[model samples]
Target: MKLLVCIKQVPDLESRFKANAEGVWYNEADLAFRMNEYDEYAVEQSVQLREKLGEGTELTVLSIGPDRVVEAIKKALAMGCDTAVHVQDAAASGKDPWQIASIIAAYAKDKSFDIIFTGMQSQDRGSAQVGVTVAELLGFACTTTIVGFEYDNGTITAKRELEGGIKGIVRMKSPALVTCQLGLNIPRYPTLPNIMKAKKKEIIAIPVADLLREESLAATTSFHPPAKKGGGIVLEGDMADLVDKVIAILKDKTAVLR
Candidate 1:
């Protein structure tokens, strides 16, 4: 079995972020980057299959970003993917969701993979568009939010996650794409030995231009950080003052209550 998992490197939210001078995107120079959380599930799903399918299964991770993203790719390698492909392109930063999908589809179209795994959405941009878009572009069966499933006889039966704890099941043959959601499987950290082995594994770098030749379908015009959260109002007083504060707050919230 040959599996391809699309991975994304996103900013570690715990670190500070600052926008570039143009305000189009974050200045990634000092920010720490990690694999998208959901993509980790996708990677784990691909790796877990190796236990069942065994020797013949080959898992490959693919990512589209600048060179810095390779750190995240190496982590996936250590996690158990047989190899990786890095699509390096500075233009990727400004491209919109469809443009990004187009780039991936261009390379994936020729790859002849039986199954492709991807995160339901990226952490930096929660568009949730790339997986399905790539499927459509490549004419593959696509299902998102797969929480559980099984594969047999070159067919896949997946349970899709729906709102309110409900799951929708879908079945499809091989050469399909699946967007992994949380709870699919726990992602394992790469041990020290595996980390060392990953350094020797194959990592093929492809220029983004080779995948995307046309002008970007869309572009980023402006971006800004979300506003800081406000501190909650604290009530500190004796009984009389507390009562007055509650009444005043309720009255302020309700115009007629005044």
Candidate 2:
């Protein structure tokens, strides 16, 4: 099997964030970057599949970002990916989901990969559109939010999370894509020996401009922190008195009652 797993580098959620001066995105100046949490599950699941399939299987990890994303690529390598591709773009942060997906689809279009793995959503944008868009562009069977996975022969069985705590089971053949969700598997940390070996792994760099088909369909106009809210007012009285107090407050403060 020839497998490709897409990964991303994102700001650590614990980082202190501020809007950029242009008010279009977060200020990345002081942020710490790491492999996206969701992508970790994708990487782990891919690695597990590769191990199960053994020698004949080949796994490649891919990422798009500035030079700093090489760190994330290396991490995936250490986790047992055979090779990696880095789609380098200094302006990657400014690209919307469609543009990002287009680049990935363009690159993977001719790779003849048997399966593709991606996180359900990116942590920074949480758009959750790229994987499905890539599938659409490539005409691959796609599944999302997959928490359980199994492979047999050329077929795959997946358990997907659904609304109201339900699980949907799906089965598909090769030449498919799956967006991994949390609870799929526990991600293993790279050992010292694996880390050393990852340094020797191949990381092929491709300029983003070469693969991009067009400009983003959407653009960010403005980004701002949510407005601060006032403290709540507690009404302490009998039911009738509480009702009267609520009406009075609404009359005084809002247009609804007035």
Candidate 3:
């Protein structure tokens, strides 16, 4: 069995971000980047699947991004993926959800795989569109936020999370897409031996133009950071005075008291 898992490199979530003078996004230049938190879970799931399917099974990690993203691909390999494909294109930095999905789907269409897995969403965009959109483009059955999955006798069963305190159990055949959530499993750290072995593994880099001809996307308006917040005021008075002040402030701020 062969599995393909899409991985992404994202800015650290806690970093302070800003826009440059050219109206482009920028982060703290010295801050570190890591694999998308959810993608790490996806990679771990794929590695587990490979282990279950035996040494014959192959797991491939794919990513679309600039050269710096190789670190993320290597990380996946160290986590147990057999190989990786990285698309180097500066344009990927501005990729919208649709464009990203299209590129991944287009490239993956040619690959022969029984299953494709992805993280529930990328941390940077948090759009949660890529997995579903890629599945649609590839004409595959998809299950998202999958907490549990099992394969037996050519059938795959999955447990999905739903809103409003509902859970869904779905069954499907081979050739499916599953977007893994964090709760699916704790991602394994790359051991020193695994990291050493991963360095010798082959990483294939594909030119972005060869995958998809054009962007097919545009950013209508530039993004900007919100203005810094003003200082806060604390109440300091007797109990009754504090109560009166709180009530007055609430009345001033809200229409409910009116």
Candidate 4:
């Protein structure tokens, strides 16, 4: 089976973040970059599938970003991916999701992969649309927030989480898209030995511009952080009094009542 896993380099969530003087975005110079945490689950799933299928299967990790993103791909290699492709260009710096989806879709279209997997959401933007968008672009059966998976006789059985504590079970053929959530599995940390092996793995660089047919998008606005919120005050009183006070506060602070 030829499996393609999509990964992204994102600012480490635990690191201290600060916007630059222009109040547009975070300072990149001192930021520690790592693979998006949810993507790690996707990679772990790929590794598990490879183990199930034995040595004949091939796994490819793909990501779009600047040249520095090779490290994120290498981390996947350390976890036992066979190879990686990095789509590099300055356009990756923009926050436009469609631009990213288009570039990934264009490259992935011709690959004819048996399966494609990605994280449920990107850490930086927290937008969970890429997997479905790419799947739509590729005309593949797609499932997001997948919690469990099983394969048999050229068909895939998947379990997806849904509202109201329900789980949806689906069956599809190969050449499908699955976006993983956090509970899928625990990602393994690469040992030093594996890291050494990963250093020798192939990391292919592809220019994003070459893959694109047009520069169809642009980001014209930026952002500044919201003001800090004040501490909450607790009130102790009888139930009727508390309800009246809560109603008054809600009426004053919001337009919820008729």
Candidate 5:
């Protein structure tokens, strides 16, 4: 079995961040970058499948970004990925999901992978569009927000987590794409030995411009932090008074008398 897992490098939001002078991007010089949390689940699922499938299974971790992004790939290597491919582009700062998926599909189209996996969405943009778009580009069966998976009889079954506590089940043959959700699996931490081994693993670098057919990048218009919310108003009164307060508070939202 051959699997390709897509990973991403995103800002570690626990650390402080500031916008660049142009206000179009973050100041990477002061930021600590880490693997996108959602991608970790994708990587873990790949690793788990390898363990189950046994010998002759190859797993390749792929990411597109600047040099710093290689660290995220190395982390995947330490977690048991066979090797990695890094699509390097100094100008790929803010490409939209479609352009990013197109780049991946362009290179991956020739790879003949049995399955491709990626996080449900990136942490920075959270557009949640790339995985499905890549599948569309590659002409593969695709599913998103997958929390469960099983492989049998040359078919893969996926359980998708949906809103309102429901699961959407899907079954597709090989040469498919899946966007993994958080509950898919627990990502393993890299042991010291594996970390050392990862340093020697191959990380092939391909220029993103080489894989890209055209410059279909997105331009950011503005950057502004979310508006601060005001403190909540607490109601401290009898049930009747509280009901009256609630009715008054919701009056503007009411479309009809009740």
Candidate 6:
């Protein structure tokens, strides 16, 4: 069995954020980067599948981003992926989901992978479109937000989480894609030996320009922080008086009450 897991490097959420000078995305200076949390589960699940399927199973992880993404790829390699492919783009932040998915699909179009795994969404963009778009571009059966997975006899069964605490099950044959959600599996920390081994693993670097088929379909025209909220007002009084005050404030401040 051949498996490919797509991962991404994202800004650590706790880092402070400010718009770049171009006003297209966040400034990267002094920011810490890490692998997207959801992609960790995808990588772990792929590694587990490879382990269960035996030594002959070849697992390759892929990521598209600037050179810094090598850090993320190395983590995946240490987690048991056999090799990695890095699609390097210095301006990766400028690309939209469609462009990103197109590059991935182009790379995998001829790889003949039996299964492709990806996180349900990225932490930075959170568009939640790239995985399914790749599946569509490759003409593979696809399921998203899967929290449980099983494979046997050349078929995959997935448990998908739905709205209102509902769960949906899906079964598909080989040559499929799955976007993993949280609670799918616990990600393992890379051991010291594995980290050393990962340093020697193969990482094929390809320029993003070679894989890109066309220009980005969408562009960000404006990017800014949300408006600051005003200070809160506290009202302490009897229930009837509080209700009257609330109504008066609403009538004075908002068109809805008026």
Model 5, span 20-65: residue lDDT tens: 7778767788788999999999999999988888898899999999
Lowest summed lDDT across 10 adjacent residues in model 2 is found at 225-234
Error of 6 at 57 (Å): 0.9
Error of 6 at 153 (Å): 2.0
Identify the superior model by lDDT, candidate 4 or candidate 5: 5
Ten contiguous residues minimizing lDDT sum, candidate 5:
214-223
Task: Give the candidate order by descending lDDT.
Answer: 6, 2, 5, 1, 3, 4
Predicted candidate 3 versus true structure: per-residue lDDT over 185-232, tens digit per residue: 889999999999999999998898887744556573675777668686
Model 4 residue 65 lDDT?
A: 89
- Model 3's C-alpha root-mean-square deviation from the true structure amounts to 5.1
TM-score pick, better of 3 and 5 = 5
lDDT tens string, model 1, 44-89? 9888876578888899999998888899899999999999999998
Better of 2 and 3 by lDDT: 2
TM-score for all models, in order of appearance:
0.86, 0.89, 0.85, 0.84, 0.86, 0.89
Better of 3 and 4 by TM-score: 3
Please identify model 5 stretches exceeding 4 Å from their true place. 229-258
TM-score head-to-head 2 vs 3, winner: 2
Q: Write the per-residue lDDT of candidate 6 for residues 1-258, one digit (tens) a residue.
A: 789999999999988789999998999999999999999999999999999999789999999999999999999999999999999999989999999999999999999999999999999889999999999999999999999999997899999999998999999998999999998999999999999999999999999989999788888987787886868798997999999999999999999998
The lDDT leader among the candidates is: 6
Q: lDDT of model 2 at residue 62?
A: 99
Better of 1 and 3 by TM-score: 1
